[model samples]
Target: MSASSIPGRLRRMNKTQKLSVAGISAVAAAALSLSLVPGNADAETEPQAISGAPVIFASAAGASQAKTIQSSVIEQHSTAEQLIKASDSAKAKAVSKEKAKKAKAKAHAKEKAKAKKAASKRGKQGASRSESRTPVFSNNLDGWIKESLSIMKAKGIPGTYDGLHRNIIRESSGNPKAINDWDVNAVNGVPSKGLLQIIKPTFDAYHVGGTPHDQYDPVANITASANYAADKYGSIDNVNSAY
Candidate 1:
């Protein structure tokens, strides 16, 4: 069997037994050589047994062992190939998933940027519109009348510059603080006041929105009186008398 066991076995045997085993091994080697010869017809016959040990076909045993080792190696190689295929498939799926994630993030970032840009554009446009619509008026009759007319237009109250001017000139001669303290309205304890000489009750009744409530306020006085005259005489242009 093993080389280490051979020395131990020889040490245990007597001198005659050792000689007998050696002689048997020699005869067995010689017989195997003759069996392998090309012209020997006994090559196919069963080998003769040695006296102290069983006959062994070393070549056939080595070939069968080599075949077993080769089969094991082939099986291991096939297993490794299958493992490699599975690993490659997993890697491919992971790579595809990563690519899709990156694409989705890129699309989301692009949409966010687009929305931010649109919001910025809308803010700029709104600022420009606010600046354009802002009006600056001087503190005078012309400015006051124009401002009141703008408010009147917005409120759907009908009146014209010529009509308002004509009535204001006749009523208080364009003086915003004008007051008729000695008239019948004054005797009644409610004096006619402001650019249109409007009594307190009449002014209160026809007060237009968007103007200050003060009777001395030019725009307020004019718009309120104009609103009253428009309701009664169709327009301020028709009011030429004490009305």
Candidate 2:
């Protein structure tokens, strides 16, 4: 029963009724006390009814009820506070994880940018090298003659740049594709061809290894003619006519 209702109800009741109500109140207070006790399962296991004559509740009863209510309120508040703290912790972890992810992504992007810059730098260097590089030689009669002389020097074949150039100018006017179709050699079915006007029989006989077989090919014709001259007249500078 409620504490405020007790006085009013007692005023309206006779002694017998008040006695009955007081006894019930005492039992209720006793049960509430037992219920308030923590870890009292064994007490609850064997239920017992309160049996006694009517008695007034002590001031301690009201104090006990107030304390129980205050304790419950305090426990609820503590539970809510704990829940809030736990939620804050979870949020903090999530924020930290997101920050870590963003940091890793930023680092990866930075590395990719650096790698791309390095590759671009290397490509620019490669282009600069290409631009700065020199040609081995031009694909022309003069280039062919100079290249042949180098090969001739390696093989111990005797020839000079000026001597070879003079012979080429006189024989074919330095034309790599020149042909003597009306010469005595041509009359005998061996037409002179190329920069040094080399006939087919002589070109084939003196053709150096590792050179093209086409007598009209400038390098091959000059090298073969030099070889023939070296063997026939001891040097190409000694040959002033068709040999």
Candidate 3:
């Protein structure tokens, strides 16, 4: 081959080599572009630790709100519990007060019944004592007069038994049933009757308490009449004018 031909062939070869190098460079550049674009897209689209700031702030805010709600709920529950406790305490006190009131009422009823029973027993005993003493003064006028004289002597009255007996015998004729029919001073239409011819007013004034009858109780009538005569006239002799 001539030198010129050799140079041309060499030039063609160099040209071909350069063209291949350029094509390879272009393909590598396109591959690198594709890879870099995908990486950048992934970095933008995928979740990143730094990009989650808003979500983290939102979560923290929600947690704080939840804590506030929880605290409020706890406070409300505690208040409700306190109210329940107070209600229970008040109910217990009311129950205790009612029980005490019932007990007091029961005790008062029992005491009242006891007092009534005691009063009834005392009344019965007094009646029995009066009944037992009735026979001693039942039917004897002279003995009743003597008892009157004894009682007067015990009371320190200045009178002899004989003088008192004589005055009563003259006034009543020794009859406990003696009555006065001719007296002009009859009161309330009831005639003066019984021992000592005592008028109704005088008999009422001299009647003894708890006697069976005002005039029929010989000892009581005689003793009361004697005491009245002594007090009003200073002695039985002073009433002899009326007798």
lDDT per residue (tens digit) for residues 1-243 in model 3: 887797687566777577665666665565556557754756544322322122223478899999999999999999999999999999999999999999999999999999999999999999999999854533466677666666666665545566666766777777777776666755356565656666666767765544444664566566666667777877664666563
Q: What are the lDDT scores of the predictions, listed in order?
A: 0.87, 0.87, 0.68
Candidate 2 residues 130-213, lDDT tens each?
988833656886788788988898888898888798899999998899999997989999989999988898899999988899
Quote the positional error of residue 159 for candidate 3 in Å.
Answer: 6.4
Worst 10 residues of 3 by lDDT: 47-56
- The clash number for model 2 is 0
TM per model?
A: 0.67, 0.45, 0.42
TM-score, candidate 3, is: 0.42
- Model 3: runs farther than 4 Å from truth? 1-57, 130-135, 138-144, 147-160, 164-243
Candidate number that wins on TM-score, 1 or 3: 1
- Please give the range of 10 consecutive residues that has the lowest summed lDDT in model 1: 48-57
Per-residue lDDT tens digits for candidate 1, residues 142-214, read 8888988888888777889988888788888889999998999999999999988999999999999878898
By TM-score: ranked, best first: 1, 2, 3
- Model 2 has an lDDT value of 0.87
Model 3 accuracy (lDDT, Cα): 0.68
